[model samples]
Target: MDTSASPLSQEDFEEIARAAARTNESVRLEFLDGKIREKAVPDGYHGRIIEWLTKVCLQARPELWLYGDQGLHVEAYRRGNARPDGCLARSGAFEGAGEWASTEDVEMVVEVTSRDRDTNQRDRVDKSAAYAAAAIPVYLLVDRGNQSVKVHSEPEGGRYAKVNEVAFGKSVSLPEPVGFELDTAPLLGWVG
Candidate 1:
């Protein structure tokens, strides 16, 4: 392969992602504009956090449904397809949808920061931009690096207006739709 020679075309990038996904069920691919990124295979602690968060949301509101690693279609950017760690949407949000749900159908997007610093920042920075650009309403970031949770909301001009944060042991209140306090205690022991 010619190193640093040419940029990958959209079709080529999508194909590469497709091929990787075919063989690895754990692979979650994201296409932002013309850039492609893959999510790291989560550890047991990460899985537990995802499950716990989902359970909390669902248990509080039986009418809503939370999906793990659900595809989000961001029409604000070209070739934008994000697979969020957890996607909480109103019931029947994906009833007639394909593999992805449009931003309008989403209530909140959850991301559990990985062990890698770069990966964690990507979730906090890159993914934050993508979701805000789509006006997806809410972006919840669970930071394992600092054992804290950040909730970003009020999207405008490719950014979020409000950012609320709290330590792992504290409870963070989620806005409407998922109106409830998220207990972060269970996530404390898994912090990096």
Candidate 2:
């Protein structure tokens, strides 16, 4: 898919959508929409980690929003939407009415990868460029398959300077945008 096409005017795309829907009954349409759709899955270790992280974030700083499994569009980039496993952002960054976020309005984005063996690249590669392009300040990735928590900061021109990684028992400090340290102990312990 081309990820660089300039956005078409709303009218132009709506016409196309209407025509396509007229012929196809199986197509579910979503465009510039802010609704989220997630597959149901058993609550596993990854989910537990996210839950713990969310609690820690709230306890440490209750004013920020803690979001999970929701789409965010940061820039006008024509890339596939990104859904962070868990995230923290201040309130009122975007249209404050729905389950999705305008990527441009987010400050921190986190992704927790499960045991989907073949789809891990979606976290490491695709989201890396997409988040950087959106200029999101911090990106925290929890890779259960690898037993690591990778942190990316200082995004410059569609990339982040690879900085820190916390394994099962370690913790890392995020100083910019927010002041909180995440201890990986709870996360690692949740694994088993």
Candidate with the greatest lDDT versus the true structure: 1
lDDT, residue 146, candidate 1: 73
State the weakest 10-residue window (summed lDDT) of model 2: 31-40
> What's the TM-score of each model vs. the native?
0.88, 0.73
Q: What would you estimate as the lDDT of candidate 1?
A: 0.80
- The per-model lDDT (C-alpha) reads 0.80, 0.64
lDDT of 2 at 61: 78
Model 1 weakest lDDT span, ten residues long: 1-10
User: Where does candidate 1 stray beyond 4 Å?
Assistant: 1-13
- Give the best candidate by TM-score: 1
* Residue 145 accuracy (lDDT) in model 1: 83
Q: What is the per-residue lDDT of model 2 for residues 1-192, given as tens digits with 9 covering 90 to 100?
A: 121355554344445545654787433222322211222242577677877888888898788876876656544434334557766877544455454456655668887775654336566776777787778888888777778888888888778876588797898987577578888877667654
Q: Write the per-residue lDDT of candidate 1 for residues 82-133, one digit (tens) a residue.
A: 8888888877888767666677878899999887655754788888988989
Our model 1 lands, by Cα RMSD against the true structure, at 2.7
